[model samples]
Target chain A: MRVAFCFDLDGTLTEEEILPQIAKHVDLYEEIELLTKITMRGLITFSKSFKLRVRLLSTIPIPTVKQTVNTILVNRPLQEFVRNNKSDCFIVTGNLDVWVDEFISREYGCAYFSSRAKVEGDKLIDIEKILDKQEAIHTLRNSYDLIVAVGDGMNDCSMLEQADIGIAFGGVHEPVSTLINIADYVCYDGLALAVLLKSLKQKYGREN
Target chain B: MAGKIDTVIICAAGLGSRLGLDMPKCLVEIGGHPLIYYLLNVLYDVPNIRMVVGFKEDIVMDCVRKIRKDVVFVRNPAYTTTTNSYSLYLGSHDLQVPFLNIDGDMYISRDNYEKFVDKIVPGEDLIGVTLSYTEDAVNVLLDSENRAIGFSREKISNYEWTGIAYLANIKIRKEGLYIYQELEAYLPIQTEEISCFEIDTPQDLEYLSNKMGHL
Candidate 1:
């Protein structure tokens, strides 16, 4: 059965969180710091933070950010495992347009939903069209048999709640308490996640 | 691990008394060259490899001292303590880490060894991975999922000795089971299928040679 698997990008896949990457890329050190503080305090939504942050990083060479994201995502050997178990899985994130579009298509063949980046001419615009991850999962439910969501940030809490099983990746980032408390399991790495999923499919899928 | 097993522990300390050999059977010449010399070169190419040694301590130490000496070594001074379990226990006590254990008497082509060793389950503690019903080998009991329920090297009426390898974690390596009991005391932990094996006689070597093309 196909389990719609939603994923958070920053701490879930890339070892480098998105804001840090934005901070390093655009040289907006002070803005990144302040934005991080607001996000940490739960004062600003991830959408607002992401849009405002990327707006600051709009001047970064698009190719450089895309390349960095691709490099980090592609080093993973999870492609074969995905192929072996692709009957179920999906990627859900709050990352902006070109980064998610190209990165997901090339590295992970699974369908993904991410925030759209407004572009003008050759430069990406600073503002992103924000879509909550929960909204992403809701859209996927029309086509999937089950949904399994994985993420860390507070922004991921709603999407995780929408899924059949939510997994919190505490190894990389401190997940929101709601996600942590409600998640079916918390995995340290892809290794643990894969093993758990394999066991789950065997025990609970189809015939059961 | 990308592969199944967390680590592969080659049992190399058995003294080759049958061959009238001065060195361990692992170090004995299979094709005019020491078997272990070939084994190490092949095993090291795989991701995670370890060694458990016992008899003729200096020889085992010296042979591995030069090449990739970083491998973990578990020594069994009581290698002759009436069972393979003793040697396995002594050598395995310190390794709280999970691993696979191979008998010293057998030989496998590099290709086959990788196929078996690389596919061993991670974190699961199992005694052996024996085969289907056959009187030729010790009838290894199997549960519904094919995990090993029991291992008896004696010619049993049921299961066949797979002659393959076994992957076990630190929990299974817990000291207590006498080698005489073999894998009898350790089979209740299976949450999934345990693969099996069948290597016990000189003829078995001939069989594998025929199967794997004389490695």
Candidate 2:
């Protein structure tokens, strides 16, 4: 059976949340914190919140954001799993493609889907599109027999719900209750998540 | 043949209403620590631990996570109408390996449990039986060879099913029967005597609390 493993980028893969790291690096801490409060209070949708964060973060040059993202630590075991299964792995994130493109390619060397950016040479620019995570699963469904999704945030809810198997990972923090309620399996440790990914792959991938 | 059984499936989804604690029985505090703490303390060596949770699962998951970060939480949404066998079935998903299945409410002697795990042989299923003591016990009818031929509640037997076993796979051919009743189809399976206490009622909890010194 052909299987696809989709991962959320921010808190799930990176040890530190990418946007927060970028915000802290460029001294946008207060602005980002206010936005986070609003987002947590459920005043805005994920797409809207992401777009707002991206637009606010656009003041920093694209290269600086990419550099900050690359400098952040990642869950090594999970990263290695994606590296080994590059062909079957994917990064489904709401972050702008322009910022993470270079970093993800350099780190994981796997296919990725993210929000589109209309960049004009490193200056603050307008938002083009915000990615809906479920779209990634829909696209992967056309090629793979089974889709296993892993994530830790509220935005990953639809993507996980659409996948054949959903795993709520708490490598950085506890998975939200909504995601946890629907997850097929919930894991806390990075090594355990990696092991679970391998086990699931073996079980479903061999059936075909 | 099986190698080492690395997976442990703990069924903690039941409402545990019979215990009248208004909480999952596994979370019941015995001597300050929850019942599951005793079992997990002994199962420290296991790498892949799957816990089937429902009926106040958030509480169970939160408590278990503090002790073991590697546990795989499997949701049993139909827990209200299902039995522990169904929870076992859910927990076994995607696992093609042999595993040790234990009920969540069992308080097993740590030393005895370690030895029981040590005695497990590859490719052979081992049933755990304790001395008949619970008010509503499923007694195991064993042959001279110590192989379980049938399970009976009416028959007076020395051993009662402790709801623990090292299984190759769970084959639920028949539905609605309790786990042991379903195991009748695979009769004459091997049995082992272990020192454990199953808390099913207030009396059982009190007995365990008083018998803690002896255990």
User: Relative to the unseen true structure, what is the C-alpha lDDT of residue B183 in candidate 1, on a scale of 0 to 100?
Assistant: 52
Weakest 10 consecutive residues, lDDT, candidate 1 chain A?
A: A73-82
lDDT of 2 at B85: 86
Query: Across residues A1-208, which tens digit of lDDT does each residue of candidate 2 receive?
Result: 9999999987789887777778986688778767764553346788788777877787888888888878978899999999999999999998888888998998899999998989789875877888989999999988999999998878888999999899999888788778887898888888888978888888899996
lDDT score of residue B40 within candidate 1: 66
Query: Chain B TM-score, candidate 1?
Result: 0.67
TM-score of each: 0.48, 0.94
Error of 2 at B23 (Å): 0.7
Give the runs in model 2 whose Cα sits over 4 Å from its true position: A37-43, B1-5, B169-177, B213-215
Q: What shift in Å separates residue A191 of candidate 1 from its native position after superposition?
A: 1.5
Highest TM-score against the true fold, candidate: 2
The interface RMSD for candidate 1 is 13.9
